[model samples]
Target: MTTERAYHHGDLRRAILAAALDVIAAEGPTALSLRDLARRAGVSHAAPAHHFKDRAGLLTAIAVEGYGLLAATLQKAESLRDLGLQYVRFAAAHPAHFQVMFRPELLRPDDPELLAARERTRNQLHTAVEGYSDDPAIGVMAAWSMAHGFATLLLSHNLDGLLDGRDPEEAFLSLTNEMFQSAKNPATG
Candidate 1:
């Protein structure tokens, strides 16, 4: 029953986004609603509409922010393996954002901000794979697919008992090394 007046003093856009992330983490993205976000932010339902037009807009904003955060994290990584590790860590740290960032059907994929942010993230990935293999594009794709698949598995708890009691990071590093080693020695079938 709070009013828009409650949001008069601060950045309502960021507040609404934080509420959306909380809701997404607790109930999944399908449960997100501007009205629910407004309730969590202690504002009128229409307040979120002013900031995010609708649910797709809100999810688009989240995707943009997620990509920017991912780009920053990847930029700080020192190597391809470190970049992969950072990708997994980012997913673990921001599951809500990670969930929405890759689901294009749930976001406004044509949004300029979202597109730019995605490109920045892709550039970071490409940079990580540059000079690591004969075909940089394929190398980038392979590294991205492996990191994304691993992060998704971890997020879904599929790696719980499969890790055999080893720490997740240690297990991930082992898997990453195994992948690279196998790439260096293709098997004949």
Candidate 2:
């Protein structure tokens, strides 16, 4: 139950979203619950429902926001390699959003906001590799896969031992540089 003061607060929605992100960061997306978020936010159990409708709705909102953020980050990149590095950095900086954004089953993929946000991200990637490949779509796919795979590996702690005491960002940049070099010169690869 929410205290009267909490119910009257103007930022309940933001509070709920922040709580949800914290929960997802600590326990993964599967553990997220509106009721728990409400408790964490000091709001009524029904408050989250009022804002998001349901679990899928909440996840959809997260996915939409995540895509928008990723698009904005990618837009700042001056090169294709920088774009890939930004992708990995975004995942590391916002693990909860990254997790929810990639799991389509957990979200309402057909939602208008989600679709628009996703297209923005796709466009950013396509523009980044526009001149690098004759088939830009394939280039976008390869770049997305490489960054997504590396981010997933980092998030899952699969690269802890493999990093050899280097910072994850440095290691990721090194790996991307090597990949870009190999793509440029297949004989050297």
Candidate 3:
């Protein structure tokens, strides 16, 4: 067997999670089944349950992982604009994680790891946005809305013709630059 397959077969938690992510990415979270994940992971039907109590617990784990990844991604940004770009890139790259991370109703709201991971990502965004405005909260909201909204649009194909064959990230940079320029010149804004 390949090394990666061997590792998954040896690590049930990771195996189940990997299978769950695949199912979620292919058919959305509602289609995920612990039993199916266990079968795919080469474990007993109850194996996934031992690690994640139920579908919500499994989803909470996914959310925690997603937020941790997002925190790491955002932490690497040198500027607010870079942070926004990273946020969009992250969502585009991890659509399954992105889908689960925002759906609070589908996860265990009290999961400590999930809460901490979410806070870490949020704090990173807040810190990045604070440099641009006196009210960091508002800046954070605006920046996150723009980036997340843009990502959603791109993922849903809502921005189809608007892209005009331009790469998504390049288009985002161009749009952000225009917005910044407009903000600098009120008459144009």
Candidate 4:
């Protein structure tokens, strides 16, 4: 067997979760199970329980990791608009996590790690609008709406089918920019 299949110790949890993501990405959430993940990870069927109490625990872990990854992606962008594009890209790239990340009810908000990751993403998004206008609260809410709407539309294929000739990201950026700019114009107020 390969060294990767050895599974000596120290990171079995991560390895199992990675294997789980691979399965979920390939098949779907319906096909995912701790025993199946443990098999893919080259560990014993009982091994996963040491990390995840059950299937729900595994799903929670996936959601937690997804939130952290989303936060990191948002933080990497130079601006809120760029972050919105990146958010769509990230969702397309990590469909496994993207599938679970948003259903907040699926995760225990009381779980410290999940909450921290969620808050980190929220704060990062809030920071992205720090220079938008004098009212940080309004600016943040507007940016949030744009990003969330764009990401949701992209994921749901709402824009994917409608944006056949144009780049969806560019279209989203252009449309939101114009609308927000128009809204900000005092002449229109």
Candidate closest to the true structure, highest lDDT: 1
Q: Give the TM-score of candidate 3.
A: 0.91
Q: Once superposed on the true structure, which residue ranges of model 4 sit more than 4 Å away at CA?
A: 1-5, 131-138, 185-189
Model 1, position 41, has a per-residue lDDT of: 81
Total residue pair clashes for candidate 2: 0
**Residue 51 lDDT in candidate 4:** 86
Per-candidate clashes, comma-separated: 0, 0, 0, 0
Question: What's the residue-level lDDT of 62 in candidate 2?
Answer: 89
How do all models score by TM-score?
A: 0.93, 0.92, 0.91, 0.80
Can you write out model 4's per-residue Cα lDDT over 1-189, one digit (the tens) per residue?
A: 542455674678788888878887777666778887877777788988988888767878998888888877877787777887777777877888987777665556577787788888888877877887799988877777776777777766788667887877788778778886777884643
Model 3 Cα lDDT, one tens digit per residue, 19-130: 8899998999999999888778766788689889899999999999999888878877888888889999999989999989999999999888988898888888887887
Error of 4 at 21 (Å): 1.6
State the lDDT at 18 in candidate 1: 85
Using TM-score as the yardstick, the better of models 2 and 4 is 2
Off by over 4 Å in 3: 1-10
What is each predicted model's overall lDDT from 0 to 1? 0.88, 0.87, 0.87, 0.77
Over 44-106, each residue of candidate 1 has an lDDT whose tens digit, in order, gives 778888878999999999999999888888877888999999998899999999999999999
